[model samples]
Target: MRDIQHIEIPGHTLSVRVDPGPEREGRPALWPSVGEYPIYDPFLYTTMTTDDERNHRFRAALAHLAPDRRILDIGTGQDLLWAREGVQAGARHAVAIEVIEDAFHKAAANLPALESPDRITLLLGESTRLRFAPRADVCVAEIIGSLAGAEGAAAVLADARTRLLEPGGLVIPHRAVTLAAAVRLSDLLPEQPVAFAEAALPYLRSIFGWHGSPFDVRLRVENPPADALLSEGAPIEVLDFNGDLQTQQRTTTHLAITRSGLVDGVLTWLNLWCLPDEEPLDALSMKTNWATIYLPLFDSPVPVETGDVLELTFAAALSDDRVHPDYQLQAVLRTADGQQRRGSLISPHHGGAFRSHSLYRDLFPAG
Candidate 1:
């Protein structure tokens, strides 16, 4: 097979990506994070269900807290995962909420098969919109996004805190943070234009069509290379679901350039603590279902040396849909020579600019 493969879109022409580095070998399989989009299928759910690291930690937390407590499971999916697990873990009862119609129907079907099905209450609606009678003693959810709060965990859980859960109630996956570091795209792979694996094409088409047009969709790199980071990762956004949870927040963080290299963008990933005392499951280090996302800031890569400091301001707020958060990042690079360069990025979980950036333009060439 040729090193690069030419593909076709209805009104656009896609050319072959040039040779990437020899060590990289193949195109990285790419997928847009569909969680916030409310698109549920076995494709996404299977990953989480099979994620032993995620499951083990959550189960451990539930076993320690769910016994004899009234539990609430948000986004329980087709399998009613946490709700069923909660009942088995000795919870008095579990209320399972799912918004996706098909998944909710399947969850309804899955309910009667579980032992003591009456112990779980099934609700087919958004947790924020539905009313709870007596409130819950614990709440469990797996609504985490690739960017941590990108799925609106801060807002959704904050609502639970006010209405659905008891005061100081336990929230599984206690805290999550979005981590960022400087990375050179070429160094991450080869110098060639990036390519999507064959499996990613259908999902790409679906996503573009889902948005009614193509946009600068977030890129999810599967199994990122270990040596891609040029600076130590720093927390850009923090979501303490159990503590002072804020739906909208703007934070500025610093990353000291540890290695001299061309900085293309910030490579961000997730680090999650399922319980207060648990070790965080790191997306960058652990082989979990969570993938890393590359937020391209510079249309043209910037040159930097060791000792350079990158001051980054990251912002997140509700998008138009009001369920997911839109992300904006502004980065300023300050060098020892008093030279400074700036770059910025806007990645909305929903409707935004179409093929405006260089990367999107390259990926979806005009007719």
Candidate 2:
């Protein structure tokens, strides 16, 4: 056994283990473990969450499933459901596929029945690439976020459906709705806009950092259409985690201020994808892993008055090529007169196998 250690990745914090001494052949090196939290393990909390209250509800809903049913639980956390008092009430056999080794190790202990060689099979790998011959009658996954795109749920589900699920296999919470609204919360900024404005000229000579960036661009929810999932095309479909999307049009919305304050940033609320045949994906109104993707739309803080209106536009498209897929996100803000303010976002792709060797980099920003 090796001692645990901590290691930091560029954009993410992760935990790993390391061998203290002696050289070993064919053994891979380990890094420090990401950190732990009270009541639950943090790493498992992010990837395999089953002990939480929200997951308990998800388990209960799955209880309604009939016995002897073949179900594929993707990203299963410690095989928690198998032990749930209600689980055996419905599912006769459950298959759990996990990607993380730590969670799987813990799961191996937590789910003792796994050793029985009956009623359960735990595969140590990602569901996206699981090569299972069993066709699931129902594919269960809690991989969802408030904004639908948060945990790469679309990608996980799409993969399961194509490779692991039986034809017409039922998807739980068959529907999902993503909602967006405009809000004013300037108190969160590190420094007030006025001071930064005075320092911009001299600061230009210094190291580049995010400053004068739009902290909050107000938004007014203008009729979010009902879509089962985010997609590209005429009506905009469920955003395919595995596919590239092209922005066909760009539009803006101006929101009226009910309260007066400095505009700092924008917040996007995403919903979990739901398959109707199965239980609703944990409801956003209920327990959710909701998060806000902040876009500092403006470099300088803008004073917003009661009844004042600020316009915002979102332009996006998914790039082509499975060898490389780029999700393009561009945002801009302006006044009613069409005068543009200081907010824009051109996102870059990072992580995964292509990060180091991608031709898309040459094609991005489209020349």
Query: Candidate 2: global Cα-lDDT?
Result: 0.41
lDDT, model 2, position 59: 54
**Candidate 1 at 271: error in angstroms?**
0.8
On residues 25-98, what C-alpha lDDT tens digit does candidate 2 reach at each position?
32221111111101124433663443353555455546665356777776565554533322465666667776
Off by over 4 Å in 1: 1-28, 191-193
lDDT of each: 0.82, 0.41
What are the per-model numbers of colliding residue pairs? 1, 38
User: How high is the lDDT of residue 9 in model 2?
Assistant: 32
- For residues 1-367, what per-residue lDDT tens digits would candidate 1 score against the true structure? 3434454455644443333333333334445565667666877789899999789989998999999999999999999999998899999999999999999998898888899899999999998898977899999999998789988798889988899998888788799999999987656654444755455565666665566656777877766677778889999999998888888999999899998889979989999988898889998888788888888888888888889998999999888867689999999999889999999999988778977788777665555
Which ranges of candidate 2 are over 4 A from the true structure? 1-53, 82-87, 113-117, 188-257, 273-289, 305-328, 336-338, 347-367
